[model samples]
Structures are given as C-alpha cells and as structure tokens.
Target: MIEVTNLSKSYGSTQALRGVSFRVESGEIIGLLGPNGAGKTTMMRVLTGYLQPDEGQVTVDGLDVLTDTLEVQKRIGYLPENAPLYPELSVQAYLKMIANLRQIPAADQPACLSEAVRATALTDHLTRPIGELSRGYRQRVGLAQAILHQPKLLICDEPTASLDPTQIVEVRRLIRRLARHSTVILSTHILSEVEATCDRVIILLNGEVKADARLADLSATTDAVLVLAEGAPDATKDLKALAGAENVEAYPTPDGHQYRVRGAGGVDLRPAIYELAHTRSWPLRELRRDVRTLETVFNELTTQVRRTSADTGEMKAGRRGSDQNPSASHLSERR
Candidate 1:
C-alpha cells in the first residue's frame, strides 16, 4: 500500500534520513522501529504530507505522495505522538471538527463519529472536555479522531504511548482490527508492540534501514535454548558433541547440573541428549529450549550499530540504542 525509495532528508548539517527504502503491503500492519531522532517521526511526517522529503519518492496505492498530496492525505489517518487536540473541546465536538475537516460526508458524519468513539472506547467521555480525560483516554480521543474518517492508511506515531498495560492491550486490539481493512504503519519504541501487533517490522538505525523482516520469522529462532539437566559435570562435554549443539554453559546443581545450550534456530539436540541420558541412566532433571525475546533482538541490532559507528570513529552524540521504552508509554502508567 506504501512504497518509499531512496528517501533522504536533511536539516542544515544534520541528516535525518539517509537513503531509506521500504515497502508496505496492503492490509499489513508494519512497525516502524527506531530510536528517538532516528527519523521514524520524520518518515511518518513525510508519508502524511506534513513534511516533504528532501530526496526520495513516496507513493501510496500507486499515487505519488508529493504530486497527489491531498489524495494521499485523504486516504491516511495520522495520530502524532503528542495529539494536537483542542483542549477545551468536548470529545464529541473534537471528533466532529476533525470529521468535517477531513471532508467526511455530512450525511455520514454522525455514524462515522459514533463508530470512532465506540472503536476507541470513548463513549462515556463524549461530553467530557478533551483536556479532562486521562492520558489513556486522551490517546483514545486522538485515535478516535484519526479513524473518524475511515481512512485507508493509518499512521500512528506511538499509538499506545501513554496508556497502562491494559490500555496498551486494548489499543493494540483496536490497531489489529484497523489492519483488517486498512494498511497500518505503527511507530513505537516498545519492541513488544511490534511483537504483539505488527505482522512485519522495519528496524531503522542511524537514519538508515537496519533490518526488514517478518516478525514471525525473526521470532522463530532455532539455535538458542535455556536448558536444565541433572548429570555429571563431564556430561556437559559429551552433550556438547551432539549435532546442532554449538556452545554449552554448565553450572553444577545439588543433584546434577544446569546447562544452557546455544546453537541454530531449528537445531533440536534434545533427542541426542535423551539418548545419552538413557545410555548412562543419568537423572536428567530439566531440558528446555531457550527462547529469545524481541527485546533481545532489538538491543542486539542497536548495540551493533552503535559499536560499528564507534569503531569507525564516526559516532555522534545522538546515536544510541533504540531499546529504551518511550516516555509516553510509561507516563500514563504511573498515573
């Protein structure tokens, strides 16, 4: 539904995006992963026509974003990190204003507004002022306005930024539902958000594309396992020889031992271990596969990027790992 080619943007001496390129398929929810100042927001802004790229081509549904700016804008629903809301406006009024501004059909405005409010679970706050709502509710209001027009593309920069865990889940459900009909580009600092909500993820680092792969594929690792076994200390060496066993870290236990085996993603040396255990009649207590998490994957990528820059002596002050959780995601949780 969206395609970006050789996109580059610069502000004075600072380069925000460098030769970034990616594609988004229709009805696909893509997570735009990056640290602060990593050009995620800039990309979103360019896609939404709020900011024009210095160099690149952006197209949505085969139409050029620059040439067909209005059409593209009409097809997209954007919820920026900090929602630009009229604080004094009641929830209902705020949505009505956005609906009208988006040129939603006058006859369908009421139903559209009603649908958005219901989708975001803001029905009870219809008459309440936007400012009076909690951060979670304010986020809901922002989301309500975005979908009020039923745009074909939804670009949310930190959609669940200021909500509690429960609220985050609720918002993720809403986004999942949104993906049923429209393409979604959700920018979040939370790797878990990508794990939970996105079908695919694009990791952006230092203004460039670092990784672009399906979430399910990356989440399916074959080489790492958290294992526990009760056997003699020498058993660790024998077990390490099993096919697919790359490295084994062993710790002694009162009964036997604890072993963490690392190898290939699909490597299953469990049967080999079982065979060895049976031959020796050793008491095997625990044998489990280690599962790598999204956090680990994200940190590994960002840390590698940081180290590479440091090695070349080209590191900048702003360069950092993208694994840190966003401020807004934690802000509302505290409240």
Candidate 2:
C-alpha cells in the first residue's frame, strides 16, 4: 500500500508537480497517466525515494519514505525509464549482484537469480552482456534486476518504451502476473498500456491530480453510449424520442443501418429501445450499449484542462506537457 499527499516540486521558475496526491491499494496495479512533462516521472522519483519531494509526504505500508528511506527502498523495486544497468554485466550476473545487494541470503542467490530470469523471460540471455542484448531484452534485464529483490511494491517507469508489439504484450503480461503478488505503480503515457494493465488510473496534468478512479468508473462518468443494432428501416426518429439521448447519428451500411447515440447524463435507454423493437417488431438485427475506450475518456477529460488554460491566457502555448527537471529548492519543498 502507498499514499502520497500534496506532492509539489519545482525546477527554477517552472513547477513540475503542484499538489499532486493519490493512493495505491495493496495488490492493485495503478497506472500513472499523463502527457510528457506532466510530472509523472517526478512523482515516481519521489515515491521510489530516488528524489525527495519539496512539499509532500509519501508512505509505503505506513513507513515514511523520507524518514525510513532504506526500509522503504527495501520494500520497493524500481525500474526507471532507462533502467540504469551496467552494460558490461551479463544478465545472470547482474541480477545476482542486485540480489546480493538486496541482502538476499547467499544460499538463495541461485533461486533468486533464476526467478528473475524466468519471470522476465531472460533465461536464454543469462550469459549475454546487457549492452549486446536488443532493446526488448535489455528491458527484461532491467525488470529482472528490479524484482530480484522480491520487493512488495514494484515501480516501473515506461517499462515498455522501446519494445516491439510482441515484446510489449509479453512485458504487459509479465506485469499483470507480478501484480497478483505485488502492488504495482506503472508510469506511462501510453493509453493502451494503461487500459490493458491497470485496474485503476490516476491522471496527472501540469503537476496536479486531474482524475483518480477505476477504469470502469471513468468510463461510466462519460455519457457516451454505444449502439449496435441491425434494423429494417429508419428508426432514427423513434430512437431519438427515447430518454436522454443526443447526437443521434445514423449511417447506412450494407448490412443494415448503424446508429451512434450520446446521452447528456447517466441514463439507461436499453429498456426503451428493447420495448420499441418488441412493439413494432422492427426486424432488429442487433442492439447493445457502447463502451467508451480509455483513449476516448482520456481525451475527453484532459480537453477541459487544455482549453481552460488557453482561454485564461495562462498557458504559454508551448508544445504542451513537456518534462522538465526539478531544482534543488523544490527538492527541499518535497521534504
């Protein structure tokens, strides 16, 4: 379990995080979602004790990160974006080294190293130099070292940054498997990754917490309706008359007519549509509610943030959401 409150960090005149706060429950896989420079890495650094926050507190299983950093580090496994590793070290040797550093008993080294290798699918690359491995293999090696210590919490920053599609699926599967036993906090800008791997998400924007909720909850919050139906004829007029529907668009397809419906609030129209079909027997082919994808929800939520800043003339109008380094003074504020 982890809790972070009011975390703030700044670098010179630019602020990296402003009052960001969130919690990760035990055995939950949480995605830290944001655009580049949204302070995702900054928050991760503080949580992992790689960097101290300027004006917030972080606790891991009730242990203060700042006061009990060593203990906190012992309970956490961190794989940074670059996964700092020695290029010359062989895969097996590097994990063995990390296991030893983690104070894994000398006799358990072999098992620990083997577990890391197997979990990351690095068995074949055990003897290969880290620098010689492909980007995907190198990422596995990085992950291997992180879990070698068997920490209770796993923190990965862009764990699949350079991997191909196959490798990305493999790594995502691996993370999900690991989360069955460990709390995972994965920081990524990839929406699909979050949708595939995270049970809940915390969206950060301009160094602040924008949204924190479960994937299902966020989806429900958006009043988007999914419609799947095959019918004989133009039922658009009848469908629109149903409760709480808007943006009702019907397009003709070879199979039948397809319709997309949007509602202004959380309204259920399935019953009405079903009754209409039953009463008229309109030769309905199919009908179902539309579920908004994580991508759509993410865009919908952040659009307001971007527009508000632009309208208020507060946003400098840069490329938008770029990662910048935090200064020492901000580090002090983190404490």
Candidate 3:
C-alpha cells in the first residue's frame, strides 16, 4: 500500500509535480497516465525515494519515504525508464550482483534467482551477455533484476517503451504476473497499456492530477445523447429548448443534422426528444446514448488544461505590455 499527499516538486521555476495525491491499495495495479513533461516520471521518482519532493509527504506501507528511505527501498522494486544494467555482465552474473546488493542471504540467493528467471522467462539466457541480447530480452533481464528480491511493491516506468508489439504483450503479461505477488505502479503514456493491465487509472496533466477513477467507472455511460435527424432548419435551437436538454450542438451531416445533446443533472432526455421530433415531423434517423471512453476523457482533460494555460499566458503578456506603454493602456481603456 502507498499514500501520497499534496506532493510538490520543482526544478528552479519549473514545477514538475503540483499537489499530486493518490493511494494504492494492496495488490492493486495502478496506471499513471500523462503526456511527456506531465510529471509522471517525477511522481514515480518521488514515490521510489529516488527524488525528494520539495513539499508534501509520501508513505509506503506506513513507512515515510523521506525518513525511512532504506526501508522503503527494501520493500520496492524499480524498473526505471532506462534499466540500470552493465552490458559486460552476463545475465546470471548481473542477477547475482543485484541479489547481493538487495541483501538476499546467500542461502536464499539460488531460490530467488531461479524464481526471478522463471517469472521473467530468462532461464535460457542465463549465460548470455546483456549487451548481446535483443531489446525485448534486455527488458526481460531488467524485469528479472527488479524482482530478484521479491519486494512488496513494484514500480515500472515505461516498461514497454520502444518494444515491438509482441514484446509489449510479453511485458504486459509479465507485469500482470508480477501483480500476483506485489502491488504495481506503472507509469506509461500508452492508453492501451492501462486499459489492458490496470485496475484503476490516474491521469496527470500540466503537473496536476486531472482524473482518477476505476476503469469500470470511467467506462460508464455519459449523460449525453447522440441524435441524427432531418427536416428542422434550426435543429440546434430547437434541441436547446427541449426539457432536460442542458447543452446542445447540431452539425450538418451528409444524411442529415447530427445533434449532441447533454442532459441536465443526469437526466435522460431521449423520451422528450422523441416526442419533440414526432410533433415537428422531423425524421429521426438515429437516437442513442453517448458513451465516453478512456481516450475521450483523457483528451478532454489534457486539452482543457493546455487551452487554459495558453489563455493565462496571453493575458499576462497583455498586462505586461499595457504596463510598459501606459498611453496605449489608457487609450484601450477609453475605447
């Protein structure tokens, strides 16, 4: 289990994380989703005790990451974006080195090595040099080393990045297998990865959490309706006037006009919409509830943040110019 509260980290003026907070229950697989520069890596580093937060706190299994860094490290296995490894060392030798570094007793090293190798499917490549292996095999080697100690928590940052489709599937299977023994926190930009492997998803944008919910909850039906109809010249205005219709937009289509109608307070406006269409003699081609997918939710949240940031930047720039030229500021004010 892990808990992070109001965790903030910055590099000079650039804030990498801002008020990020989340909890991971035992045995749960959580996916951290965000675009590049959205603080997914920063949050992962802070959680793993590799980077300290400037503000806020992080605890893993009730152990504070800052004060109990070693203890937390002992309970976590991290596979970083770039796996830390020695190319010169053979697979067996590298794992052995990690086993020793993780403080596995000599008596337990053999069993641990065997289990890790088996779990990651690296038993056949034990004697091959790491540098000689393909990217997929190297990723397996990275996974094997991370799980060598059997930590309670596994943190993987972009574990499937740059791998072929077959390799991605292999790594995803390995991650799911890892979850049987340890809680997982996976940071990836790939939405399909989360959909395929994660139980819950936390979406981050502009260094802040935008959406955090279970996959099931996110895939639920939206309180909106999609309608395809014809014979109404002012379909947008008519739809907006219908009872329970909160927001309405109508777009011209090849066959007819397509209307996106949002309901008020989770109300279903389908019955009222059908009644209105029948009274007005509009031919209804299609009427159905709109369902929101994970991709749709992700794009909506991230794009809104980008637009807000751009507007704020423009406003600040305008104020700065106005201050520099008071005459123009007065003229604009008068206008």
Candidate 4:
C-alpha cells in the first residue's frame, strides 16, 4: 500500500509536481497517465526515493519514504522508460548482478532467479548476451531484473515503448501477470494499455492530479441513448421533442442517421423513441446506451486542463501589463 499527500517538487523555476496526492491499495494495478512533462516520472522518482520532494509526504506500508528510504527501495521494483542494462552481460549474469545488488541471500538467489526468469519467459534467452536480444526480449530482461528480488511494489514507466503490436501485447500480458504478486503502478502514453491492464487510473497534467477513479466508474455511461433510424430529415428534431429528451445530436452514417439522445436525470427516452418510431413507421437500425471510452474521458480532462492553463497564463500576462500602466488596465478591462 502507498499514500502520497500534497507532494510537490521543483527544478529551479519549473515545478514538476504540484500538490499531487493519491493512494494505492495492495494488489491493485494502477495506470499513471498524462502527456509529456506531466511529472509522472518525477512522482515515481520521489516515491522510489530516487528524488526527494520539496514539500509533502510519501509513505509505503506506513513507513515514511524520506525516513525509511532504504526500506522503501527494497520493497519497490522500478523499470524506467529506458531500462538501464549491461549490454555485454548475458541475461543470466545480469539477473545475478541484480539479485546481489538487491541483497538477496546467497542461498535464495537461485530460486529467485529461476522464478523471475520463468515468470518473464526468459528461459531460452538466459544464456544470450543482452545486446544480441531483440528489443522485446531486452524488455523482458528488464522486467526479469526488476522482479528478481520479488519486491512488493512494481513501478514501470513505458514498459512497452518502441515495441511492435505483438510485443506490446506480450508485455501487457506480462504486466497483468506481475499484478498477481505485486502492486503495479504503470505510467504510459498508451491509453489502451491502461484500459486493458489497469484496474484504476490516475491522470496527471501540468504537474497536478486531474482525475483519479476506477476504470469502470470512469467509463460509466450517462443518461443517454444512441439511436440509429432511417427516415425523414426531421427525425432527429422529432426525437428532440419526445418526452424526456433533453438534447439530440445527429451523426452521419451510411444506412441511417445516428442520433444521440440525452435525457433529463433519471429519464428513460428509449421507450418514447421506440413508440415514436412505431407510430411513424420509421426503420430503427440500432438503439443502445452511449458509453464513453477511456480515450474520450482522457482527452476531455487533459484538454480542459490545457485550456485552463492557457487562460491563467493570459490573465497573468494581462495583469503584468496593467501593473506597468494605469491606462492599459482601463483599456484591457474595456476589451
């Protein structure tokens, strides 16, 4: 389990994190999503004790990260965006080095090595030099090293970057498997990976927490119906007039006009639409509740944040200009 509260970090004039906070329960796979420069990596570093936050607190299993840095590091397995690996060392040798670095007992090294290799499917590539393996295999090697110590928490940043479709799927499956043994905090630009592998998601933007919720709750549909009907052009307008219908928007389709009918709270417009269609003899092609995908939700949140930041920047600029000249303030207010 992990808890971060009001975590803030800065690099000179740039604030990489600003009052970001979240909690992760044991055995949960959480996706950390954001655009570039979103402070995901900064937060991970702070959590892993690689970097100390300028303000706020982080605790792992009730242990303070700053005071118990070694213990926290011991409990975490980190695979950075670009995995740091020894090119000349064979996979087996690399894992052995990691086991020693992680302070695994000499007696337990073999079992840990075997388990990590087996779990990551690196049995065949153990004897091969890491430099000779493909990118996908190299990523497996990275994962094997991370789990070689059986850490309680796994932090993976872009674990599937630069891989082909098949490799991405393979890596995702591996992450899912890893979740059975360790809590996972995965950071990636891929939205589908979050949908496929994460139980919950935390979206970060401009160094702040934007949205955090279970994927199921975040993807829940509103009180709206998607209706596909083939009839007169006024069908959408008529549907808008139906009882409980609040808003209607038509989407172009080859076979019919697809209208999304939103209803007032607790209103069911489906029955009314069905009755209207029956009365008008219009052909109904499709009718179903509208559900938003993770992509849609992510875009909306991050875009809104971007617009807010732009507006704030413009406001600050206007205030600075007004401070230098009283006449400019009056003119700006008039505009």
Best by TM-score: 3
Residue-level lDDT tens digits of model 4 in 1-335? 99999999999998889999999999999999876677889999998999999999999978999999999888999998899899999999999999988889999999999999999999998889999999999999999988888999999987887999899899999999999999999997667778889999997877888889899875654445444555545587788788878777766677767777777664667777888878987777777776656765665564466457677662211111445753321111111
Identify the candidate with maximal lDDT: 3
RMSD to true structure for each model, in Å = 6.9, 9.4, 9.8, 10.7
| TM-score leaderboard ranking | 3, 4, 1, 2
Once fitted onto the true fold, the runs of candidate 1 whose alpha carbons sit more than 4 angstroms away are 224-292, 312-335
- How much lDDT does each candidate structure score? 0.78, 0.78, 0.83, 0.81
Off by over 4 Å in 3: 226-269, 272-287, 313-335
* Deviation in Å, model 1, residue 26 alpha carbon: 1.0
Residue 231 CA displacement from its true place in model 4, Å: 25
Model 1 lDDT vs. the true structure?
0.78
For residues 157-234, what per-residue lDDT tens digits would candidate 1 score against the true structure? 988876888888888998898788789999976677888899998987767988898878766754433334443446
Deviation in Å, model 3, residue 117 alpha carbon: 0.6
What TM-scores do the predictions have? 0.76, 0.75, 0.81, 0.76
Task: Tell me how far the alpha carbon of residue 167 in candidate 4 is from the true structure, in angstroms, after superposition.
Answer: 0.8
- Candidate 4: segments with Cα more than 4 A from true spot: 223-289, 312-335
Instruction: List, residue by residue over 251-300, the lDDT tens digit for candidate 3.
Output: 57777778878777656778888888788777678888876677766655
For model 2, residues 1-335, the per-residue Cα lDDT tens digits are 89998888898888999988788889999998877777888988999888878898999999999999999998998999887888999887788788877889998888878887888888888889989998878888888888888889999998988789998998899999888889999988777788899999887777888778798765774333334345476777877887777657666667777776666565656666778778867776666777666665565556566568778866521223224422111111110
The global Cα lDDT (0 to 1) of model 3 is 0.83
